[model samples]
Every structure is written in structure tokens, then in C-alpha cells.
Target: MTLPLSDSALIGTCLAATALGLIVMTSGGGGAAPTPDTAAQTETAASETAAAPEPSLPFGAVPAAPDAVDPEFGAQVRAYLLQNPEVIFEAVAEFERRTAQSQGDMDAALVQANADALFNDPRSWVGGNPDGDVTLVEFLDYKCGFCKRALPEVKALMEQDPNIRVIIKELPILGPESELAARFAISVLELAGPDAYDSVHVELMEYEGAITPDYLEDVASDLDLALADIVDLMESDAVSTVIEDNRALAQRLQISGTPTFVMGEQMIRGFVPVDNMLQAAAIARQ
Candidate 1:
């Protein structure tokens, strides 16, 4: 039997033990004899724990207790995620923030690069008048709320500046609805003329919330346009091809959002003031 050490002695003993541990850890004696066995055992245990996986959805964040889509699948996913819900959520948020930030940074860099490729492509710019002195290229989605509100301003800009041409590149990076609407709009461009495209463009932007097939059809009819023609063209691969092209260009240019404007060499984003646009357009003419 051993007598209990004084508190000071015990404290000194702990520090010595810690120092010894540090020495062992740093000097490679950590892997000697039984230490190697323990290290391997610890590594194996960690590997197994990683292999086993925690709950996927994390604690309390599982979609539903009894999932309709394969009960086993939900359970397995949740189990894979485990009690790390906060970690998962934070990870996702951090990823999005980082990705958006990186994209924003890359966008500035890419826009400055010599045009080996282009965001809208030089051909899409052809949508504007062939000989127009000033070209205004817009990277827009049909579903963006801000784009709709800015329609009057867009129209005003177009009206005030006749020589200023607008290139409406259907960069539908928002969601499925945005893509569909953009496709439909492009098809409508084929069905009708620039007027119809502009009318439909303005109308769709003015609409609030999610755009559906039925509402889209109604909007087309309201424009005194032929729905059958637009629908046929919308279903065609041409729309898909154009959108794919737009996505490629956006990826190259790093345009992640709607209503990004390229007036001459300047890349102005969002709903810029009309006065600012007027200033920019005037400068472009020069």
C-alpha cells in the first residue's frame, strides 16, 4: 500500500507525467513495444468508427421518423449522419458561402481575361441589332424577382437609347422553373419576333413566385401569341442546347446570378440605376 502524496507533489507528478508523454510523443518512443500495439489498436478503432459512420441527417434533423421513400434508406442516411447535425448544417452553409465568394472572385478575374470564350458568346450578342454601336449583354433568369421589377427601367433604357442594343442571354441558373421559363421564352422568340420576346420577357418577370406550365401557357396566350408553336419549340432540343451553351458561358465568366450586365467592357451586376446605365451607354457610344 502507498501513502497519498501531498497536493503539491501530486501536481508536480502530473506535470512530469505530461512532460514525459510529450517527450515520448516527440522523440519516436511513442511507437516502442506496447506503445506500437496501442497506437495500431487506436488507429484500427478510429477506422472502424469512421467505417461504421454516424447518423447522416444528424440529431433531430431527420426528414421524418417513418419515411415514405424507403424506410431503410432514411434510417441508413440518418445513421450515417448521426449526432453531427450542427456540423453538417454549418459545413453546408460554409460551403455555399465559400463557393459563392470564390465564384464572385473568379468572376472578376475571368471577366478581365481575353475572350478565348465568352459568357453569352458573340453569336448570342447577335440578338441585338447587327450594326448597333452599343451592345448591352444581359445575363438573366426568368424567375429572378429583381429582374421583373427592373423591366420598366430596362424598357425605358431601350426606348431612350435606340442605338443601344440588348442581348438577352437566357442564363437560367436559378432552378428548374427558371430553366423551363427561359426555354419557353427562347421558343417564343422563334414563334414571335423581338416584340413578342420583349413582351413575354417583361410579363414573366412581372409574375411573382414559381412559374408553372399552365401559367406560362396562359401568359403566352395573353400576349396574343400561339401557344402550340411555342410549346413545340420548347419541347425541342434547340432550347436545351441553347441553355447548355449559356451555362457553359456562365461557368467560364463565373456569372452565378441573374441580371448581370455587360455594357461594352464594363460588367455591371444587379439592378443598376437608370442614370448610371445612361451614363454607361453614352460612354459606350463614344
Candidate 2:
């Protein structure tokens, strides 16, 4: 049996016991093991680790540094890009291919919508086979250098392929001289015939000076056409309507320049080689 000490002495004994207990527990010699609450906390942490989402980084790869991306990665990418510069060209080619396809589709749709005005307008000069299976439509300006160059190629095509019908629409956008030439040609076709118009067309295309009324009278004289008669016919509302209708058709078909060709659903926007023209005509036949 132990006797009770004074209050101060009792307090000192309690403090000593507490310190000894701490030392024993630290050394694993005391019976004061982990409490139930601590054990539960440890188990809970382990469970959370197993249930958490997996990281997005690939296996065996370390996480990127927080301060910056790896410099070597960017350098390697740049070096690889420089080594394969043709990739940019290939991308441009693909873009152009898609753009061409889209433009072709739109042109085809417009052609179909305005087929009557484009293909069968009686006002336009029609050459080659009148009842041909395939028809080639040409939008031309009298003063265009390309149109002048196209004269021989067109003549060759008609001579070679008699079954290909060629319809010419005079789009006089160059200047007054061009309109004068077109009006003269239209008057020739109206007064004389297609043969006279075709003959005058060749002559006008070959002419190498500013086309004035005097020059036109000379062309009429060469073609055996009455100059006064054609001059009177040129001023008629009938001739003007033909040119105005062609202008409207050009607007609808989006004809921005001269020497544009249309065969079936295909539209050749600029000067393509004679071989390409023949190829387009053949495709139209099919």
C-alpha cells in the first residue's frame, strides 16, 4: 500500500511517469501501441491510393518539369520539319486540288442552269458540225491576244474533228475597238450568213491595227459585204440585243476573261493547249 504525498510532490511524480512512458513507447517497449483511430487512417490512405485515376503520361516516362517544356523536344521537331520541307508543298497541292474541284462543281452547275443561253443561242456564231454529238463553246474577245492565238488552233480542231460543233460568244470587254469588231462580226452573220461571219472572224482576228469604221469597211469589202448595209444593221436593236444577251450570259457563267472554253460539264477558264482542248472534246463525246 502507498501513502498519498503533498500536492507539489504528487505533481512531480506524475510528470516523471509521463516522460518515462514516452521513452518506452518510442523504443517499442511500452504497451501503448497504435490506437484504433490511427490504424483506420492508415488503411484508408492505402485504399485511396488504389482507387485514384491513372496518370495520362505514358508508362516509364517521367512527368514533365513544371517550369518549362523540354528544349530538345522542340529542337528535334524543328529539325525534322526542315528535313521534310516538301510537306508544305504537298499541303498546298492538296489545297489547290480541293479548290479546283469546288470551282469545277460550281461552274458545272451554272452551265447546266444556263444551258439554253450558253449552247443554243442563235445569235452566237456556230461553226463546225451543226448537228455534232459534242459541242465546244468559246467565250472570246476580239482584241484579246489569246483569242488571236486561238484562231489557228480552233480552225485546226474543226478541220480535224468535223463532228465537234464550236459556238463562239463575242465578249467585247477589252475596249471600244473590241466592241466594234464584235458588232461588225454580228452584223456580217446577220446580213450575210455563218460562212461570211466565219470568214470575217478570221480576217478580224488577223488584223493588227486599231479597228475603226474605215478598217471595218475594208473587212466588209474583202468579204464582199455591203459596208453601208452592215453599218445600218450594226445600229439595229437586234444586233445590240445579241451582244447584251451575251454579256448577261457571261455574267451568269462567271466568264471573267477571254478564250474560255466549255465542253459538256468541263470549263477551261484560260488558254489550255490544243491537246487539252481535243481531250476535253473527246471526254464530252463520251
Candidate 3:
């Protein structure tokens, strides 16, 4: 797969994310309800609304007031924006100022880079191999075809390199199928131990298409594991918690898709080249 968007990518993604946020806010950010106003309704019927939190909106803050532009025009803008606001002029200017300042702080942040403190703990990536030196975290979707294709590479890494610890992170983003598969995967891990985790991991990844309860059962049967046992595990609070932990970690890592890798201090998101991965391992060892 293609490399995820980095700095520049983040900019566009953040903007798009902001736009979507605005839509949601307009729908309702959960503040005081708006009253019918001349701007929103005809002038014959005016209404008032408490200040809305438009932070989620693109550019941040509510849009221009009707009095500032044409009284009528401003009212129209305000009416729409109180519901749907854009930073436009003022917000853009401020966003640039604050953003530059935030950028300037990066150097200080980098200076305190706690490489080992940050990465050594597997809990940082959810339940991972805390003891392994070359810790490899894989963000995967159970329903992803590419993830299935990538399973062999992952299995080989663990089998061949004892020191190379691999953390299988479930990032089910395809749909509800993905989520259910993930829930089931966790249940298998809890009941079957690490070996079961390995078996289920490989089987799910190796198998293709929209994963379901049936596929899970089929795989379980092949592995001589009972479907009921796994299904019961799926309902366990601990299993759900682990999946939730994985989801939270993925968000913190800014992981956008499946097959992302974190080995040593470097994070290689997407399908990493074998030689490149080897090089990263070498660096970690040194």
C-alpha cells in the first residue's frame, strides 16, 4: 500500500477533518439551542441563540455578523454559520499565528525525546511484547485483503527472529465486519493464550474477504478450537477492553491504516520493504 500522509498529508487531513467537524457542529455541538431570529427566519420573526462553541468548525469560531457586512448579508452569514461557521478572514489569520507558535515549540519537544521511555513499554501500543528488543507493532484490519496478503511476512518475522517481538494491533476500519472480527480475535487471544493468538492471527490475516462470525467459526474449527469458547470470550469485558485499548493507541500514534509497523524508535506505517525493515532492525541493535 502507499505511505500515509505525513506533515503535508496531516495538513490536508486536518483540514478535511475540520470540515467534517464543522458539519457535525452545525448539526449540533450540544450547546444552548438557537431561537428563531430575523436572520434565520424572516425579519418578521427574530430569535436569539446563546454563543455556540464553533471550535470544531473550519478555521474555528463562528462566522461574520450581519451588521458587519450588509445588515441583511451579515445576518444571513451569521444565521447559517451559527449553524455552519467558517473562519474565513479573522480565523485564518489567527490560525496561522498560533500554528507558527506551535511549530516553534517542536524543537524543545524533540530535545526531550525519550526514545526508550516512550517505546520500550508494550502497553504504549496496547498489549504488546514489552520484553522484545525489536518490537514490531502491526496495525491490521481483519477484513482487509492486503492484511491477509501481509500475514506471511509478519509470521516469518516472528518465527525467524526470536528477538523481534511482534504486536498485532487490530485496526478494524473497513466496517462492522471489521469490528466483529476484531472482537472475536481478542476473545481467541484471551482463551487460547499466545499460541491461539498466533493461530487466529495468521488464519484471519491469511483468509480473504469480508470476515464474519461464520468465517471465525470455520477458522476456529480448522484450528480444533470450539466456536462457542471463542464466542463466549468475545463477550468478556476484558476482551472488549483490549480492543478498545488498541483503538486508543492507534489514535495516539496517528495511525491511518493497516499494516503500520513500529520497530525500535522508528515507526514505519504501511507495508514496509523487507530490506528497509531489516535496516531498521539493524539500527535498533546498534
Candidate number of the best lDDT = 2
- Assess candidate 3 and give its lDDT: 0.63
For model 2, the local distance difference test gives 0.80
- Note the Cα lDDT for every prediction shown: 0.69, 0.80, 0.63
Question: Which runs in model 1 stand beyond 4 Å of their true positions?
Answer: 1-130
Q: Give the runs in model 2 whose Cα sits over 4 Å from its true position.
A: 1-79
lDDT of 1 by residue, 101-187 (tens): 775566546666824344335435334354668777777888786677666776778778777777778888778899889888888
How well does candidate 1 score on lDDT at residue 94?
70
- Tens digits of per-residue lDDT for model 3 on 126-201? 3334466776667788777767767666656656666776667677788888888888777766676677777777
The per-residue C-alpha lDDT of model 3 at residue 143 equals 78
TM-score of each: 0.56, 0.72, 0.55
Ranking, TM-score, top scorer first? 2, 1, 3
Can you rank all candidates by lDDT, best first? 2, 1, 3
User: In candidate 3, which residue ranges exceed 4 Å CA deviation?
Assistant: 1-132
